[model samples]
Target: MSSSHDTHAAHDAATSHGAHAEKKSMRLMLHVWRQRDPSAEGKFVTYKLDDVSPDMSFLEMLDVLNERLIAGGDEAIAFDHDCREGICGACSLTINGQPHGFESETTTCQIHMRRFEDGQTIYIEPFRANAFPVVKDLVVDRGAFDRIIAAGGFITARAGSAPDANALPVPQVAADAAMDAAACIGCGACVAACKNASAMLFVSAKVSHLALLPQGQAERNSRVLAMVEQMDKEGFGNCTNESECEAACPKGISVSNIARLNREYLRALASSD
Candidate 1:
């Protein structure tokens, strides 16, 4: 048997080490959605990650987990992320029932591990919607958004160079409104946040951004019509004005844009006559 002095020394050392470890790192219980493919059924799988640095971004934490998984001969969790600077809306994850992890004006890649409590359970999953089918574990096909943009989200007016300052002068209010709408990165968070899976917020942002500008006048009517048509054809649910999308938007996109979309649609219909 160990001597009493040795036992006391070992116990003190262990207690000190535990305190140091607790102060420097964190342990998280992650309930992540696992899916093999689009057709395969997905379910939540628990994973315990230890020694996590609070300074690490959410994606970095995932990176550490994936490194361990790869070394352990387990399939790594697949998640989308790009421009970890948060410019790209590629980090389309729903964290703890909130899109982009409950941060105001932020993306998933911008989420820091420090926001979570030590040993707290985190629920991570892909953006759910009929239009956004799961491609793999935590990866969903957001190509539907690209299609909507391609349909009529551009202006055909050729711009060889910057226009003269006085040329095509726009109202200050309209210019500011257009810029605000243009901030949308098309991350599809609005759709994920809505109970009905509506893409109105996304569509409205695009429409409002262009429609408020003078250059966009040429195709304003057709733009709204074609985009809305394609949106419906893609199986996105209709907006019932629940405003869930606005609350969940990372860019703080307002629901007023949806109202603008409705007005634009009606105006387009009347112009068709």
Candidate 2:
């Protein structure tokens, strides 16, 4: 082939690849729920966003959508987020019928646009649970979790002289178990995804972490009783062994912790006067 013809063909191929890349980065329709207040009715509002980068995090994509809305003289979507690092558990959403979509062991804040295809229709809903009523678009009142914790989930150690780290030598097995339970981030995903909307998994993790530790031994019995009582008071349902909480938990906390919580409650009751 002539050198001029070869160069022309290469240019054509590069142009075609650029066009394909642009097509691949095209827009999508995001149907997000909007509510003015807890008592107000919510409706799905559709917004179209074009040329969204696949590398954008889910929250960043929403930011782009909000910017467009403001530019178009429309109200922006409201959502909760903090520590976008997926640690605060504030970013909660029910995306496409999954707590955090098809991604295993991830929070809503950690989801990115790469999981979705161009021109896909995405449905975003607030995490739903009786205890977590909608406060606004994609925002729910998760104060129920806080109340449960306040009842007696944590130890009551008074601050004083710093104790030696090795003063209480915990067994390796017990320490490891405690650490596993302590991994819970207090995200209400478990409650949102459960058929019964039970908070047993969250409560169990707290109960198990404290029950297994020596420093927590003093109030172990009372802690379990008080927390479980507060859980019921918060309008959370009883666990029927459906195990939905474990499947939906972002932390993958086991259902066995619920079993442990039940056992601890029973033991506490039996030993009580």
Candidate 3:
């Protein structure tokens, strides 16, 4: 591997900003979670990085460390990331026991080095849950989420062309609620932060987004049932009405969605009976 600069980048997708502004060298002690694979026992391995740019994103700092590791003939830390943008939610990491660190409404990719003290120790770990088993260092298998979505996260209604914007008249309140739920990126931070490892927040967001829209009404009854069933089958614990999931959520998806999910589920059950 080569340096993370000028073409031979270690992780070209990862990004940082304002490298020249407020140039301060940050020395950090990183106790990062390390696991070879799913069957391997995971542990926190300490690595010290000096002269790090305060402008670098958390992943970019890791990239710099990885470059150094490669140059020194050591194994590079493995973590999941794509699009460096927070929208993908691919760069999920538990920072200092919080889902995406102490920052509010921020993803791991959006966390910059400036958020921490110059010589502080930071703990980085993969999001933990029974369904999201560790794949490697700081990377977990979040395929259970994909499975849940696959079970019934889509509407089967097909259209030949784009409908007019005014064709469907949706109430502003419903539209707003659907938009709020649609913000979920499936990061699984809520699961990691929850003591019960509940995925209700994630599931509820997925369910409520569709249920509030008219286009989603066709399969609305079955969607909730199938999704909740798949969620249970994936070993995610039930929600105990704890708001930790919402508090940990990077998107700030409301717990109200969970209430909506329960209502949807009950309605589905009654309709089935």
Clash count for candidate 3 is 0
lDDT of 2 by residue, 142-190 (tens): 9998898888855676547877889878899999999989989998888
Model 1: lDDT equals 0.87
Error of 2 at 223 (Å): 0.8
Give each model a TM-score. 0.90, 0.88, 0.90
As a whole number from 0 to 100, the lDDT of residue 45 in candidate 3 is: 92
Writing each residue's lDDT as its tens digit, candidate 3 over 60-110 gives 999999999999998899988896767888978899999888887788887
| Residue 157, candidate 1: C-alpha displacement in angstroms | 1.7
Q: Arrange candidates by TM-score, highest first: which order?
A: 3, 1, 2
RMSD of 2: 8.3
Task: Evaluate all candidate structures by whole-model CA lDDT and list the values in order.
Answer: 0.87, 0.83, 0.87
In order, what is each prediction's RMSD in angstroms? 9.4, 8.3, 5.4
Which of 2 and 3 is ahead in TM-score? 3
Q: What residue pairs are clashing in model 1?
A: none
Specify the poorest-scoring 10-residue window by lDDT in model 2. Answer: 1-10
